[model samples]
Target: MKMAGKMDEEIDLGLAEELGVEYEPYKMSDDEVIEALRQINKEVPWEIPVSKELLPYLRPTILCEAHHPEIREEALRIVEGAETSIDAAMMIFYYMISRIKYAMEPPKTSPDALRTRKGNCFTKAGLQIALLRSVGIPGRYSFDKTLLKVIKIVVPREIFEKMPGKFTIHQSADAYHIERRKWIQCDTTFDEGLMPFPYNWNGKTDLLLLCPWWRLGHVGKSPYFPVNELLGRFKQRGFTKDFCAREIDPFTEHLRTLSIQELCKHYKRTLGRRDADSFAHILYFHFVGHFRDVHYNPLFRYDTNLEDLSDLQESGLRIFEPKYSVEKFEEWSVSGIPFEVE
Candidate 1:
């Protein structure tokens, strides 16, 4: 199997080289590029998709409205009779980690995740956010750079080190605490004996939820992206999803067959840098593809008919309207990203 996979990779690279595949880096004007991405992000078409008479979750997305009746009810049940919202929130976060085993994949609908009892960092983050949004809590995706680097561990040191550098972003949940009057980072991807959950409730600082487990000294998910802390970085990271799928995987494979000096020469001429910035347009697309249901999942690639959506609609106490538009974007600058959406 290993040899076959390696041979497959070699063929892919040979095909790329024969076709004149190579990187051509250029400085993208931040304003023009970001505006284009923001437009694309907003354009993912959505509609009621079902009769307004049915369940809440059944309705299609309008940005952060990922809430569903089951998610809300379960979250409320776990936070069972908490005296304060904070306590309730804490309980819900705990329930997320305790219940879901960690895996690596793009997020799925809350019910699917709950039924399976497993998901990647993205799934974990999505689960937490669904709960938060379901119960009327305000939240958004949080993207962190320094934190994303910890994900390098998942790639295997050999393949990971061979890449230009850290491929892209890491994300988690962020929620607003009303009484505290601030946003808190809810790193639910891991469960520490303590949270090893030491965030001081000040609502300002982000508590690194599983510092010891990840790092040995600190590291990686329940699959959440940080909020717009770095906008350009967000665009940069999202843009990588497409770039690597189209360019890097085979290019990297081709590089594997070359001598050190040949690799360096190829690197400078084709990639333009010896840093993550070189293949900055790329991410290990496979890292997320194994689980992302884009092509297979109806809810993602195709809209469900009115009847099927009825089963998936929201049946909750409250329908938390999204405060932010799905179109919200910015903080990072990504160059060489074409505005094309497939």
Candidate 2:
């Protein structure tokens, strides 16, 4: 089976090279190579089949947008600046968390939603990979499933016994591993001083239920997934869905109508106390908080140990510093916003 897998990979690479797909030929292990190929294959449009000559360029375009001169230059700068493992890790984290802003309202693409900073986990991961690649580093995005169980509130034991079903939510975190290097887990959308260590988990990990949003449906169920389909459905009904979708213009207008405090209040009411707390932790740690039903899981939880940066550094892991100086961002303070819904 291993030999066959190797043969299959060689065939794919040969085909990709023949098609002129611009890709980095990294000397990775077979497993790493296969995984990278899988990611590339999954992301590119296979329907509009390209000539073997075109495959090389296809990857560079899809992966790095190398054609964009400015992006290319910035990516190179990031790569050039990394002098150590800590520097590299911090550079990637700071760039994604501080530079890429989380949209007040969802936008279609990371590049398009240019706030002071903006991106989802995917976009942030892409940005980090692009920067890493530009500097001659090999990195790939990875994900894993984690088990989470909801905590019981101050209810009588008898009352709790009457509740139906197990409480749990599956959440995803994106990470990139360098060849012979450590893997860094990043929640770009999370804020500083708000998360725990080993940023990504591989097995049955326990998480804290900080926000109701974390308890929502699975990943693709969020507005970020099938955004257009959901928005179209909303539009057909005169744009009346209570939950926000990716209608940038309308979403921006909606944001404008609510103060930061009002927005927090609305979120609290929608998510409830425990869930809201978890959401706040996400905001404080990852910086990429967004509203999604999947994030609203009753079982959403986080490890308090992961919340400390000092602990992470002591464990020989590097944490990224915030991109923006705290003073600069504090001007738009949403700190006073209550964690629970009104």
Candidate 3:
């Protein structure tokens, strides 16, 4: 039975079978992704629907909420072990960069990211933020629209084709440098093996720094950033109050019991009836990377370039090398059943 949110006719079955991830490929443009959010602005209730069968494990993790005491202290200890302040910050960054593999794990708290070492950019950044703040390293959200192509290194091509070529709203974290008194954009999104690849990041430049100067999601016009006006009226407020970690913890054990295939089947069916707006939100925040594209927020995006930060190597920044190697690339992708293409 097809659910209300029909898989766009473009779903590629053979490719899905080949990739071992079940998704109906329907080609959508940037506009469609943008429009999906509009439903959120209007009078529709914003929520991720959970089926009765999976209700025990369907609680969503609040990605924006920060500062878990125990987790922060543990991260602080790791930072304290480092020789210098910058070294400490980079140590935190390295742990976050090294630990996570971009995938479809439900958004979890900072402690969860460290404990599990698997999540998309949002959860990974939560760990980074928690660790940085514990050691007095200032950090904030730096959301931007990024090309989906950049993710090709990690995502298989056939699955990648289903999504828009560009994600107009992608995110990473920005951390302040205490000694130099500059905020460095430490984009910690790419996975373990793919970390060093040029598509993911280079040792130098802001190419991978994800950050923001002020509270993002504020409304302002931008010829370059398309969704400026829609930002203010569209995104709901006080939504985070409902996304607490403690509230979600009850569902964790139950969620762990399901196979990835079982979980995805539930996600597809429950979300099938969702209107485009909630659908987009689910696709980004809940299902994969948090790629919400609220229009007004982009104006606050701090401009960054691929400037080399090699001079800051003294800050403990260095190239990434994966400790464990994958024997088969295809196996690596399938092992993590729920992840995005870009």
Candidate 4:
């Protein structure tokens, strides 16, 4: 089901018997099974004080510094008027997707994200998890594998063709909803203007704007910062700063050529627009950062460009990999029926 310790490959569950793993059948009436599924899908109101089992998600890791004073303060400031945990989470989600600048360079840790307001998907997920944990909400990360071709809609053909990998890691943060007893997945990697999907999170549905385009396949869930493992993998694959520049610099140059209006119009046509006017205002801000700093480019913000922070990424290597004891994922049976584990 898994390949070389990477994302799981979809397989026929009936082959489990062939693989020597015993297959188990469901024992319940159709109505009972339907009721059980409804319970799984039910949206219950968020309640306070999650169980002790969720402690792993509440604690701080090197990448997710929930215990840091700065993280706590910023979290409190962001959710000042929130009455419930769900409200606080929604507030945090909006702040992350709107205020924070998406970049692939350094300052990836939660505390660093608050300091710089910039990071890639993992680091952004780190900030989200840290902020939620700071306010006593259990938070974790879910990983997926997205093909590099998915971003071809945004990136120019020349740049897309030259990019290295076939697939890359995509990540999102999860907030535990106590009443529902489930973690709601929220992908805050793309800012509001950049993403065509409506900017909304109801503390129930998954907010993955890019999933519709990326054709993402599930990897696994982790209570700890899985970026460490990713960093290690990148090192194993010989990914370096210069190599990143090879792929990134060309895209950055291309952005310089296009006007903001052109960029918006291009996005509207390829990715659809969330509003009436092309997202000119948002693209303006994006251009401001892009022009001011050569490191900034909207097209490949999802790609984690390790321009600097080699020390932090190196330090995280192998230190924060997730253990199966605390991981959660949707499971399937031989009959193709799904099951949940907590």
Top lDDT hit: 4
C-alpha local distance difference test of each model:
0.38, 0.34, 0.38, 0.54
Task: Tell me the deviation in Å of residue 215 in model 3.
Answer: 21
Per-model clash counts, in order, read 37, 68, 14, 0
lDDT of 3 by residue, 1-342 (tens): 111122113223343233232222223343442343243223222221223322211111133222345665566566654544455655665566555655533344455566666655655665666565444444554555444444333333444465443433455666655456555666677543332111222112343422222123422211111111212211221112123223332343344344433433333343232321232232122111111222111110112232433432333322222221111111122222223322
Q: Candidate 2: deviation at residue 106, Å?
A: 10
Q: Provide the TM-score for each candidate, comma-separated.
A: 0.40, 0.40, 0.41, 0.58
Candidate 3 TM-score, true structure as reference: 0.41
lDDT of 1 by residue, 1-342 (tens): 111112101112232233222212123233443343344223222111122222222211222223445665575567565554455556666566566755433334455666666544555666776665455444555544343344442233444455444334455676656456566676666322111101122223464432222233212322223222222332333323334335433433344454333433443443233322222111112112211333222111112253332332232211122221111101110111112221
Residue 269 in candidate 3 has what lDDT?
41
Model 2, runs deviating above 4 Å: 1-69, 78-81, 102-121, 143-180, 189-246, 252-260, 282-342
TM-score: model 2 vs. ground truth: 0.40
Say which prediction, candidate 1 or candidate 4, comes out ahead on lDDT: 4
- How many clashes in candidate 4? 0
Question: What is the alpha-carbon lDDT of model 2 when measured against the actual structure?
Answer: 0.34
**Candidate 2 local lDDT, 116-210, one digit each (tens):** 24443344444554454333343333332222222222222333354454543222223223323343444444322222111222111222223
